[model samples]
Every structure is written in C-alpha cells, then in structure tokens.
Target: MPVPAPTLAAPGESTTPVLAAATDVTKSFGRAKALNGLSLSINAGEAVGLLGPNGAGKSTLISLLCGLRRPDAGSVEMFGRNPLDPKSRLQLGITPQATSVPQTLKLRETVDFVAAHYPEPTPTAELLVRFGLADMADKQCGALSGGQQRRLLVALALVGRPRLVVLDEPTTGLDVDARETLWQQLRDYRSQGGTLLITSHYLEEIQALASRVVVVDRGTVIADGSVDDIRSHVAISKVTLEARCRRRPSTLGRTRSARPLRAPERPPWSPRTPTRRCAGWSATASNSAASKSTPPPSRKPSWHSPAIRKPPRP
Candidate 1:
C-alpha cells in the first residue's frame, strides 16, 4: 500500500534546501506515457533510493533531473535553477543505466577525458586506483570485461567530486565483491555530505545505502517514505514448523497410499499421503531421489530473454 504524502511546508516557511525536484511532472514518448504527475524532491545531503519493477518511470525521472530530457508538463529543478543551466549542473554527476565509452580509447584516457570537464576533478590516477582499475589503465575500453566497464563508468561519475550524484542501476553488471566495494564508497561519499539519488533493482542495495525510498509504478509516484516505513508496508510474513519422531515409522510402506487419515482415528505416525501413487512406495521413493539428483535445465543468456532484450524505456 502507498503511504500518505508528507505534510507540505507553507509559503515562507523555512525548510531544508532542495537540491533536485520534479513537480507534478508528465512526460510521454510516442503513445506511451513515461511519467504522469510524478512528484519527488531530493534535499541536500540526502541518500534517496528510487525503486520499482521493470517499465516503471524511474529512468525517465532521472533523465529529467539530469537535464537529458524535459518534462512535458510541470518543472524539474537542480540547485534552485533549471537543470539545463550549466551553472546548476556544475555540481551534478550522473551514471546512466546503459553506458558505452569510446572503444578505441584506453581506460586511463577515458577517465582523463571525463575529468577534464570539471574544474576540480579527482586525479585520473587516483580515480583509477580507487575503483581497482589501475592495472587495466592501459587496456582499450573494448578489451575490458562488462564488470570492469561498469566500475569505470561509476569511477568517472565520481571523478568530478560533484555534490549531488545520480546513479541508475550503477551496480548492474558487478559481482558481489565489486558491488560491496562500490557501496562502501557511496557510504563514504554520503558521509562527506554528498546528496545521492540512486535507482537499483536490488532491494538489499537500497536498504544498505538509502535512508528514504521513493517507489514509482505505472509512471507515477506510488510510495515515498523512510526505509522502515516502506518495509512495514511491504514486509512479508513467514512461518516455519519443525517436528520430531523417535524412530522411523513402521508404516513407511503406506506413504504413497491414497487413503486419508482422520486425526481422531489414525495414529500420527500414519499421516495422510498423496492421492496419487506410483507402482510401489519404494519405487516412488527411488524416483523422487533420482529427480532430486538430476541437474536443473540451463537458463538462456540474459540477452536472449525477452524481458531484458532492451533496457526498459521507463
């Protein structure tokens, strides 16, 4: 269930400065609506997680915040100015969901190129080492593995030392160790008062880095609250049962029988069994064991899956 919206501040009321905001925004592409009256705000020094299932408006909102696209209605602001204004974006950094660098450029060159855009960028050597790409600095971008490229993309985003960092699925292709490393770096960034707006499919990732969460679904803001609040609304209940028997039951042979056992008339040892049976109880047991031993069918590669054939438009 969606949580109630927070109370609004009255005009002239002092409040935390908003670093980024999208007010009653609506955007459409062709006949598809990507965002519909979605409103969100990021205050200074916040770590906000934007989450939803595939085709949600998470990416569309990020693009608007970064000035890559404009809203068809309403407004998007960054640092109290239009996001398209160069001054407003000077303190901004972004890592999009799908990224590609010039394949011909070497890793070190790529980092240097991006760093040159900012007035006070992190040293290229330091940035490369920090992301564990020091050894691969001389390799061409094309030669790097998917995980390496992902790491490089994140490293470039931070090279500018921007006050606000927006990341879209930043750890998509990363392994467990690499993902943990990135998370630690982000935590440190937040410690230094850097505001962050991140979207990721991994719920645990959001729980680890974000204090607040904003859920988008069907091109609208469905829920917005602290992590605890969101968890309370969506938390699942689980029950576990454990039973013990003194010894193997003598009626093991009747396990596959179709007969139903009435609790009042039958001993607990002779529990109800399946309505269907194999040739014999022993044979059924053997078949079940064999099935357990068999390996599961191999899954097709992600690219072959229809669900992920292309990055979701939303």
Candidate 2:
C-alpha cells in the first residue's frame, strides 16, 4: 500500500488533501542530483522538521513546496488545491532563504506591508510584542540585528493567519534565547492547529520543536520519525555542562561512529572533538579531515562558552 495520509473528499476532486502531499517529486540541475525522489506529508496542527546536509537539495524542496518552481517529475497538492493556484497562496506562509523582508522599510512598515497581502491579518501589535520587537518596530528590517530580522520574518509568516507555515532555516542567525523564543512560538502555533514544515540545521531545535522529523540526503527521504526513533538509527552521543568561566572538551562522551558506515552524514550528527574538559566541555569523535571539497560552516561556535540555555519548557 502507498504511504497513506488524510485526503479530503470533495466534488470534482477525489484527490486532494487538507495539507500537502507530494509523490516521487524529482528535480535535476544538470548532473547535480537536486532531488532524486522526495516525498513528504504535512497535516494540520503538525510541526515536521525537514533536515539535510550541504547540497542535500533542501532549498529545492522549499521552492517546490512554495510553488516557486515546477518539478521535472511527480505531483504536489496543498489543501485540496494546487500550490501554483493563486487561491492556495494565501492559505500558506513562506520564509525563504533570501533576506526575505525588504530593507528601507521600517519594522512596522514591513508588518503592515505583509498585512496588506491579506484582507485581514493578525494585529501588528500582538506580533511585535510576541517577538520582542516592539522597541524596534520603527527600525528598518535591513538595520535590525540578525536575530531581530529572523523574528520579524516569523512575524510576517503569522500575518496571513495561515493554516500551513514553511520556515526555511527560520532561526538562521538567532542567539540561543531568540531561537528558543521562536521555538516556543512554534509550539504555540502548533497548539492553535497551524501546520508547519520547518527546515533547519539545528538538531536540538528539531528535537525540541518538531513533532516529527524527515531526514533528506541528496534529494531522497532517508529517514523519517520522532526524535528518539531517528536518533536511534545513528550512533551519536550527548554531553552536558554548566556555565563556565573557562571550559574544555572531553573524550568521555564522544560518539562511537560506525566507521565507513555512513548514515547520510545528516542532522543529529555533529562533528567530532579533539580532546576533553571538565568545567565546560562537549564530546565527539575526532579524526583529521581534509577533503578541500566542502566549504567551512557559515558560523563557528565556541566550545569554551556556556551551554545554550534553552528557555524553560512550556
């Protein structure tokens, strides 16, 4: 039997779903395998994480989800409607990779700007305060701090009062607090029955906020399930630490990688460490790597710092 998800029964449309359903979606950019065959199902009130590594074709998936591009093969449907249809556009929220909100526009202007897209949007005041941007409401999105920009983008996503929201690296440059704040916001959105398809690199973010995670590698759906279930598929480790004036990483909790037994090199699998520490430290497998093929990470975190103090659970 094909993977089964809810399908709405309506006249002239025996094949439609309340959320989204794609089958054998494939896209190719020359020789690069952008999407071999990817499929995902998102339901109302659900928060599903879309995960992958560099060149994993995640951006392509987002583009297809938003109706920005046509797949070379397969089908996509949203809420008993097609994404490319103008009618379905308003029912969805999208935060793309491009520095989404325009500059020159004050934060308030941006909010109001997006509000214009809908006949009735949520109150601007509520979105501003919910994202801790009341003070910066008059500032241009271009001038706002990275975290602030991300927050405002999220606010825009909530404007349409959409039934489905797709966030691409939503917390891309946010501080731990800001990221955690958004995490809570997502949970609240889920509680209100808004569905979400989130693409992120933060493993813990998916673990904490996503109801289910679908791991994609090279355009293929390699793994999909709850956090525990996915984590159990790969060999990884966890390390704990307190606030530190000075810290060092330890070998105690480093991962026991199944050498050469690659598992997509996907999310929930951070790189290995060199040595150890007590006051403050993390663990991981360590080996010299020099492929000269892949570029360095966009951001390099300091291990000598404090643990990302997550907001107390809701």
Per-residue accuracy of model 2 over 1-314 as CA lDDT, tens digit each? 11122322221233333487777999998888799878877766566788766677888988887888888998878776777886767888887765566879999988988888887788898889988899988887888877788888888888888888999989876777887788777777777767788887655566566767787877888777765455544322122222111242332123222222122232232332111121111111111021122212211122311123333334
Residue 80's C-alpha lDDT in candidate 1?
93
- After superposition, the stretches of candidate 1 with alpha carbons farther than 4 Å from their true spots are 1-15, 236-314
lDDT for each residue of candidate 1 in 1-314, tens digit (9 for 90 to 100): 12222322331232667888889999999899999999888887677888775667899999999888889999999999998887888889888899787899999999889888899999999888888999999999999988888888888889999989999999886777788778877887787778788997555567667778787877887778776555544421100001112144344333323443331132344333211110111121122212222211121111112232223222
lDDT of 1 at 46: 70
Please list all clashing residue pairs in model 2, or write none if there are none.
Answer: 248-277, 249-276, 249-277, 250-276, 254-284
The best candidate by lDDT is 1
Worst 10 residues of 2 by lDDT: 279-288
Alpha-carbon error at 102 in model 1, in Å? Answer: 1.3
